[model samples]
Target: MKLSYMASLAALFIALPAAAQPSTRPMGPGPMPVFADFDGNGDGRITEQEFIDARSKRIAERASEGRAMRGLSQALDFKEIDTHGDGGLSREEFDANQMRHFQNRPMPPAR
Candidate 1:
């Protein structure tokens, strides 16, 4: 009886974690995965090299999805985004640029 009880307890313990996990993430677009690894050094700032590397990754991902991007335009260059002239892009600057870029893009009419 004790052995059976122990086995049952162990099974329940193993099952609890899987059962407690949420089935799926909430619907709709959440944060982009690109930014998660953008700051490679974890210094809370992105150097030009970091930006270029991350941008390349993003471009590759978009290409694979059949949505190839020609890359950043001359107007919105890295130095342009680095408003502080500190040679590093802060979180605020990155977010603002992303927001502006998305907002200006003309949307395709729905089917």
Candidate 2:
């Protein structure tokens, strides 16, 4: 009985470190930003016009902050992101675009 207890304790010690190690894989994209933040009229959906207006606002804010605006000037290709073929985008479609964009983007080199 004493030998068995010692073996069990040894096994637990060996497993603990492995379990405690942080995961290396990237985590899934979390919930999208509040819809009202983008959905201008509180209509619960985002139209292409609203999206463009919001993007323009964001670019202007970045420019005011003296941040680089190189990529912000271009318009968002709403058709490419509107996966459901609807005239407007639901919150899910917006979030999916965010995830796809992040996954496909090239990572910056480590310092």
Task: Name the best candidate (by lDDT).
Answer: 1
Best by TM-score: 1
RMSD after CA superposition, every candidate: 9.6, 9.1
Residues 1-111, candidate 2: write the lDDT tens digits. 999999999999999999999755433322334556678997888998998887677656655555443323232488877889898989898878766655655443343
Question: Tens digit of lDDT per residue, candidate 1, span 1-111?
Answer: 999999999999999999999644322222344444678788899899988888778667665555524323523778988989999988888888777776665443343
Q: What is the C-alpha lDDT of each candidate?
A: 0.70, 0.68
Estimated TM-score for each candidate: 0.60, 0.56
* Model 1, CA-based lDDT: 0.70
What is the TM-score (0 to 1) of candidate 2? Answer: 0.56
Decoy 1 TM-score against native: 0.60
